[model samples]
Target chain A: MLRYLVPLIVFLGVAGFLLKGLELNPREVPSPFIDKPAPSFSLPKLHEPEAQFASKDMLGQVWLLNVWASWCVACRSEHPLLVQLSRANIVPVYGLNYKDEPDDARNWLRELGDAYVSSLIDYEGKVGIDYGVYGVPETFVIDKQGIIRHKVIGPVTPSALDNCVLPLVRKLQQATAQTVVKRTEVEGCV
Target chain B: MRSLTVGIVLLCLLVFVPLAFAKEAEYMVADPEMEKTVNEISAELRCLVCQNQTIADSNAPLAVDLKNQVRDMVESGQSQSDIIDYMVERYGDFVRYRPPMNASTMLLWVGPFLLLLIGVVVLVVNLRKRTAVIKNDEDLSVEENERLQRLLAAESSPQVAKRGNSSSQKAGEEKS
Candidate 1:
């Protein structure tokens, strides 16, 4: 009985892992930047080329860094949702206009409605590379301390926003920058 | 005949034209040494857009960009591991064609040998059990041996004639 049972258990364990693997999306490579500080960059604003927008400006605020381009067809799908989210005033959505002509980007916003608090021009896609953005329409939920908490690889649909991003953002918003203090407190106790 | 000639010309153009263009686009770097370093690094890194391909083999825009990134890093005199680490820092270990042996991948590295070990154990146990069963069948106890000797003596006596007669009668009945 033990002999038969052991083989059956091992077979089931392998089968279980394979079944779980079948359900997983292999296309979504997990980002290394999660829980790490957001890569910092200052770039010219799409609307005003003379003016600059920096990532450090978003410190002390829970925000969304959306990597997008006019050329990206998927970005159009998530545009309305982003616009709505921006209007809702729940979280500020900033755009990193990845590898787009300034004119085309501005025109796209004019047609689709601007969803960003400020759209920074990543003309060479340097900032996008820094953010570890492979696919356009990637979204990152960043906390007040400028750490990237979560990343959405593809288009941000309504369900994803409601289920994952919004909840995390709300939680991050509620929490204070007490991590440093908490660490010291634990040290004191120890 | 003229149409056939045109068709042959078209085929030649289709095949050779791309070959010419491909030769031009094949080597992105001029320096052979720099190209070798870039190629080595690219071979280790995965193309994010085309998940199956290494950046060296992929033609996707992102793959090209990554190759150029590798080239730039090579030009700047960074070591191969340093460039790979930079990519890993951005893309995680998934960007690597060869996964590093860490706590997560320790099982992946050791799994085959572990399976072989289990198989050997099972085979040994099964062989031993079979040998034990055969030995038990071959070995007879003292009381059993005595009983066998008594049966042989009884068969050799006049009881054999009686048994033989009974079997012959049964055979005759079957024949009838």
Candidate 2:
């Protein structure tokens, strides 16, 4: 009887793992960049070609770095949500226009309504590669110290924005504000 | 005239086709040693977009980019292991076509062999049980053996013996 139960237990164990795996999105691979410093880049602004944008400029601010392309159909799906989030002014969203023509990216923003603080042009996609972008429409949440907090692969859904993105943004913002206050207090004492 | 024109167009295409292919071949390393290292490393790395294929074999855009990255790294004096380590560091062990043995991958490495061992044990146990049943059926007590022999002796009387001998003779004649 014990011997008979062994196979059933093994089968249930495998089934449990399979059920858990089924709930997981295979494309939602965990990024190694989390808790690590965000990869730095200096690329031209998409709207203003003569101007440039760099990751270092966004230091001491909790921000979203969204990697998008005009050619990516999935970006269209998430565009409206990003626009809504931008309108809320919860967090500053920066766009990395990945591997797209400058004119086409400008045209897309013109049609879709711009949601980013400043869209950076990664024309050669070298920045995207550094960010470990395997697919387009990936988003990263970076903290005040330039450390990456979270990475969301694929389109950002409404639920993801509320549950994952918004909550983390609020937490990081509070943490940074406290740190600023503490720093000022120490400086006054000095 | 139309057929001749078609033939000329086909001839032109044939002549230009090799040139297009030659241009694509330019991405390969100039040094044969470096090319071999790139090939080996590419074969080990999985194509993220085309999950089942190695980067070397996949034509997906991401795969092509990764191949180019590998080629560039190989050309820049990076060791073969360093390139693989960089990819694994970024993409995790999932990027490796052949995952290394570690705590996370222990089940993947051992699950099949464990299953085989269990199957062999079950087979041996089942065969032993079946043989024991057969042996039990064949086993006869001393009293049972004596009863069987007595019954046979009673059945073979003088008249039966005479008839049996005649039947045996007939069977012998048939065999001959």
lDDT of each residue in B1-176, candidate 1, tens digit only:
99999999999999999998888768555799889989999999999989989999999878888888888899999999999989999999989998899999999999999999988998999999999999997688987777556555655678587875665565457449
lDDT of 2 at A186: 24
How much is the lDDT of residue A68 in candidate 2?
A: 96
TM-score of each: 0.79, 0.79
Best by lDDT: 1
Look at candidate 2 and tell me the lDDT of residue B125: 95
Tens-place lDDT digits, model 2, residues B1-176: 99999999999999998987878845645688777788899999999888889999898888888888888888788888899888877787889999899999999999999999988998999999999999996687997777556555645666688666765666558559
State the displacement of the C-alpha of residue A73, model 2, in Å, after optimal TM-score superposition.
0.5
What value does DockQ give for candidate 2?
Answer: 0.45
DockQ of 1: 0.67
